[model samples]
Target chain A: MYQLIDPILVAVLLLNFAALGASQLRTVIHAIALQGVLLGVLVVVAHNEFTIWAVLMACAAITLKGIFIPRLLFHAIREVSIRREVEPIIGFIASLLLGGLGTALAVLFSNTLPIAQEHVGSLIVPAALSTTLTGFLILTTRVKAITQVVGYLVLENGIFIFGMLLVEAMPFLVEIGVLLDLFVAIFVMGIIINRISREFSTVSTRNLSSLKE
Target chain B: MLISQIIVHVVLLLVMPPLLLGVIGKTKALFGGRVGPPLFQAFFDLIKLFQKGSVISSTTTWVFRAGPVVGLATAILAGLFIPFGGHASPVSFSGDLILFAYLFALGRFFTASAALDTGSAFEGMGAAREVTFSCLAEPALFFGFLVLAKLSGSLSLTAMLDGPMPNSWGAAGASLVLVAASLFIVLLVENSRIPFDDPNTHLELTMIHEVMVLDHSGPALGMILYGAAMKLFVMCALLLRIVAPFDSGNIWVDWGIFAVGMLALAMVIGVVESIMARFKLTFVPTFLVAACLLSAFGIILLLR
Candidate 1:
């Protein structure tokens, strides 16, 4: 059961990194939604126990991450008329290179840590860590505010993957609370993007430089 | 008693904010030319403001009213897990640090949202800058925590501290120094101290954290100020745990040393604030990126 869940999650995480390395706005949001769905499926499959709460959590994940968020973001993208994150401070190739380096580092670092739990599956820690780094890479390197939001979502997803390793230990209430906070956070980011677009006439954070000393 | 732990955590989490501010202020004053106010000055100020009340902005909604409360609440809530002086945290579990870190992010997210809610360009600029720096700083801070967890064999801040001090000045010492440097940068940027944004800066155009709080007054202002200082205190405590000589058994000595260390650290921050000019806003990100590189180096050293 652990082995089956691990590879699919790793593959999804890698795709999430690949998405971060992409330049198009539409592609990035879609990738984020895809990540949400992948994570949701992973949750259900790994637990291998079908309960109403679990199903509801999975549904909530799909609604917020897979559908609602991307739809809201795409609307904002259309409203702002900005289709691409052009000329990110780091080029796509460079971001991908860093992403690869980060993945290698994550695997290497995880190997060094002493593991106490015999039943614990491999790959979760490294996958989560690399996905997190890739998300940060996108966040720092991108000029677009929208893209940064995507990066943040990816980062949160990576954290969620990390959380799955200790799902039994972590309270369901806390999980619910985290998901609620994340949904609200993304909603707030959508609002901020709208304001940024209207005020500066561009969603590119590069132009919001009027306040710098 | 579990109940007592809960009570103590709650009280400390709430009251310590103002006390932390007072300590920071008094230390800064001692470092400067003049005498500072009493150690309880922030506490007094809060009482005064709470009694006096506030004038709501016309441009704002319920978000404005709820923002400061949420910020303060979240800060106090996150504080519940920080584990003062090797006391077991009220909440502890796997990946608790992620919650610890993100709870602060939760406060920040709300604070930024509230800042943007005001529709003031100055506040918006401040929010943008805060989030931008946080984007870089959060990872560095986490990476540092990661290394500490790795070295110590535990992720809980308390357990990590409970682990053996990395013997000698090798990779462990290097990483400790690296993490401390990065966390200190976070303390500055997150707390809105000098070289990042001057807490006492008169100019709104040059402010990040301060500018966001410009429109807030009375108890709301009190909460923001208190929250930032307590956060600084928490970071100081984490640093002390890293550097302190005693292990978990000598709680009194460890805490006493922590308090004294925090006082000295506050004075150092004050002296730095007194002497240095705020960096150009663009340079703030550069500064944070430098911290990230340091943290990355620390991790690489640990791996090697």
Candidate 2:
């Protein structure tokens, strides 16, 4: 079970790169969905002992983050008719390099902090920081609202990864609450995207500045 | 024992490359639902090319001729530094990995220089694209080597790849997987395969490796084809050593396994070519950079 943890986490990290390097909004969404499913598996694997709560948590996570949220984003892309292009503010190559740099830094930064004895060799710290940094990168660098929403979801996935370290301290109910909050957040973002696209005839956040002054 | 292994390496290096190309062609044909050329078609083509006459352009210099010769020489030399299926390389030193890498570089330099010597704009463009793309690819190759060096604690290609490789896989499996992925990308790019450059395409504007050799004919073109196939073989051997680093205590069996692995890899390349469309010229650099990131991530994973 412990051996399974790092590979799943490493896969999640690779998906971070896939998202950063991808030009298609649909590709980015799939990457996040895959990351979500892998993380859901990580939730079960990290616990060592199988508990009813762990299994239940994995099921909810797999459904919401993996299936439910991504399905919402796919529909959003379809109805909004944003097509496939991500319209990044920076080039894909530059964004990929920056993502690499952030991941290296995340690993470096996590090395300095003291971690719990059992969690020391595990990739939990570096994976969490790296995933968060990747999410932040997507959020800041991309111009599309759908991409930004995907970025926000990725950022939240990073938090969920960190939350794995404190599986005991982080109550199952709290976990449920976090997932529901994310679900609601996406629900709101979807509505905003539909409304903005309907009003402006585009999803590029670059146009939103006209409301200023 | 060393002499025997070296003989086996030399024989395979000489004889096996064309067959690999044949396998790739046959695999692609199967995918396209046609009965392609026979499995030995590459060898027949090479024989025909060598028997044909040369047609040098009036504008060309000696560099145009030197390109294929130098390329073939370097590729054969590079093959010496790579172990064939757990057998130590014919030539191994503390820092042969650098030599191994630069041999390919030197080969590319000469090839590009030869293309420029022809003074044709299309060949020149192909040469420029080849050199430019290699700038990204060469570093990614080094990064993959870096992972191997760190894992095995040696700078030599033989030491970096042989014996305890299975153990290294056990300890650093994720990093190895990343390295394997990047190296596959490198292989495709370096050899000018489909998705990077269509080897089969003769259209000047659309090809890279084929376009550069527009002036070469007869034996020179044969040398280029043979060199390309051998380069693929060597690169595939490097990849195989990492992914399947097992020695069954019988030399013949080991060699057979390595040969089968090379054939399988050729077929896989065929499948990739069939399924994926070639990238636009502008996106090629982006693809190369992604390869760099893959290997860089391999190093990062190893650091932890």
RMSD (Å) of each candidate, 1 decimal: 19.1, 1.1
Q: What are the runs in model 1 whose C-alpha is more than 4 Å off?
A: A1-213, B1-10, B165-171
Report the CA-based lDDT of candidate 1 relative to the real structure.
0.75
Chain A TM-score values, per prediction = 0.93, 0.97
Could you give candidate 2's per-residue lDDT for residues A1-213 as a string of tens digits? 889999998899989989998888888999999999998999899887789999999999999999999999999889887765546788889999998999899988998889988888789999999999989999998888899999999999999999999987888999999999999999999988988898888888888877657
- Per-candidate iRMS values, in order, are 10.6, 0.9
Off by over 4 Å in 2: none
Per-residue lDDT of candidate 2, residues B1-304 (tens digit)? 4788889989998999999899989988998999999999999999999999999988888888899999999999999899998888899999899999999999999999999999988999999989899998998999999999999899999989986798998889999999999999999999998898899889759788888888899999999999989999999999989878888998889999998988888899989988889988777888788888889989988987
CA lDDT scores, all candidates in order? 0.75, 0.91
* DockQ of each two-chain model: 0.02, 0.76
Look at candidate 2 and tell me the lDDT of residue A73.
92
* lDDT string, candidate 1, A1-213, tens digits: 564675466556547654755567887888888888888877776566887666777788788889888898899899999888888998765566577578768778877777547533366777788788877888888989989988888888889888877766777788889899998998898888889888889888888766957
DockQ of 2: 0.76
Looking at model 2 chain B, report the run of 10 residues with the lowest lDDT sum. Answer: B203-212
